[model samples]
Structure formats: C-alpha cells, structure tokens
Target: MTDEADPKGLIRESYRIEGISTGECRSIFVDWALSLGPAMTPPAAIALLIARYAAANPGHPMNAVLSDGLEAPPEARRRGGRAARVAG
Candidate 1:
C-alpha cells in the first residue's frame, strides 16, 4: 500500500514529532485522507486507522482525536470559482 493510504507510519511519526499537537495531527490526517486514491473510502480508511492505531497506541493522544474526527460529520464543501454563482 502507498504511504498515503497506510496510517501506520503516519501515526507513529505523529507521536515522535516534537510539539505536534492533536490539532496539528488532525490537519495532517485530513491532508493524508484527501491524498488517498479513488480506491479507498474515507470512512473505511478512518475505521482501519482507528483499529490499528487505537489498539496499539491506545494511550496516544491521536487515538481519541482521530476517533472523534471519524464520528464527526464531514464538512460541507464551499462553492467557489465557477460554481460560486450557481451555489447562490
């Protein structure tokens, strides 16, 4: 699997990163999710990530943060550029 699709390294690295806050990790995770190829779904990816990291790194701050992110509803996309007029 591509590095982007797999959360193992990312999770571990996030912990090793000095001064990396949960909020920063959340943003990183979002970027990682958006970079995924078409074959993967965000929900499925999130579930897998939780299963792997949450179990192994249960005490890690990212576990709870990532779990909450998974539970939260996806944000609505803001229409802009050519779609701005149509959105209004």
Candidate 2:
C-alpha cells in the first residue's frame, strides 16, 4: 500500500528503522504479511510493499531483501506422519 493509505504503518516504519538487519526486517516482514487480511495473499502483499518502498527508498535494505524473500522457496515440513515439501 501507498504511504498515504498505510493502515498499520508497518511498511513505512520498516523503511525508516535504523540499524535493522536483513534477518530482523525479514522476521518483521513475515509478521506483517501474516497479519494482513485473508483477502490479501502473501505474494500480493509482498508486491505491494515492494512497489510502495523499493523505488522511493532505494537505499533501504528491505528492497533487495524483500525481493530475495519472495523468490526463496518455501520450507519443507513434516505433516500427517510424512515429510512434505511446500511448493513455492
């Protein structure tokens, strides 16, 4: 979402936070993505967030980090007594 209509300020704050590591920002990004409404999918949210901040905040670490996170494959997990790999 755009800064003007950012409801939670999570994206805006992410760009402004000082000395935040890529890992820390990634954790916060996951939380923010999860907290979004059911209607908003993770990929869509990531795209919106990238659009909102990437160009304007070019120097922000999140720009590259967020893109990398989106491209990374989902983690594997065990379910129903069997190991299952999540399809990205």
Candidate 3:
C-alpha cells in the first residue's frame, strides 16, 4: 500500500503538473481513493467514512457531527481498555 502522506503529497504534485487548482485535484484524488478502499486500518476506515459522508452530505459538516461522539482508537483510549462505542 502507498503511504497515506504520500498520496496527499501526490495530490498536490498532480495539481501542479496538470495545471489544476489544489482544491480541484484534492477533490478528484479523494473521490478516487474513497472508491477503492475496504479501509483496513482505523485511520483508513475513518478517512473512507468521512469521504463518503462528505460526498453524501455536501454542505453539512461531518467532523462537527462526529468529533465528540466517536471513540478514540484503541491505542488512544485510556489504559488499553476495551473499545468504546461511538455514538453517531
């Protein structure tokens, strides 16, 4: 798998090479990436979910909707405890 950071950087490079704006290239790359994922890792899963949610909701802000409600990753949760429920 490609590094997550690299894809983001490639998106920026693609914009420069193709003469598109950064926003336009990012949108294109995001759309493409979201389509391919089964999202094995928590971060990847979150990213895919956010992308799909954003595509569907458009003007609605997903982070505001999820920020406080979602549990932190197991690694981030206190004391290596069981996973917490994320209320969505």
- For each candidate in turn, the TM-score is 0.62, 0.66, 0.25
For each candidate, what is the lDDT?
0.70, 0.72, 0.44
Candidate 2 lDDT over residue span 1-88, tens digit each? 5332234677678889888788877777776765666666667777887887899987778887678757869888657433345543
Where in model 3 is the C-alpha error above 4 Å? 1-39, 58-62, 65-88
Specify the highest-TM-score model's number: 2
Superposed Cα deviation of residue 60, candidate 1 (Å) = 1.4
Candidate topping lDDT: 2
Residue pairs clashing, model 2: none
Question: What is the C-alpha lDDT profile of model 3 across 1-88, one tens digit per residue?
Answer: 5544333343324423534554554465555445443425435544644554545544433333323224564565453334444433
Candidate 2, RMSD to the unseen true structure: 5.8
Order of models, best lDDT first: 2, 1, 3
In the range 27-46, model 1's lDDT, one tens digit per residue, is: 77766766666776777776
Lowest-sum lDDT 10-residue window in model 1: 1-10
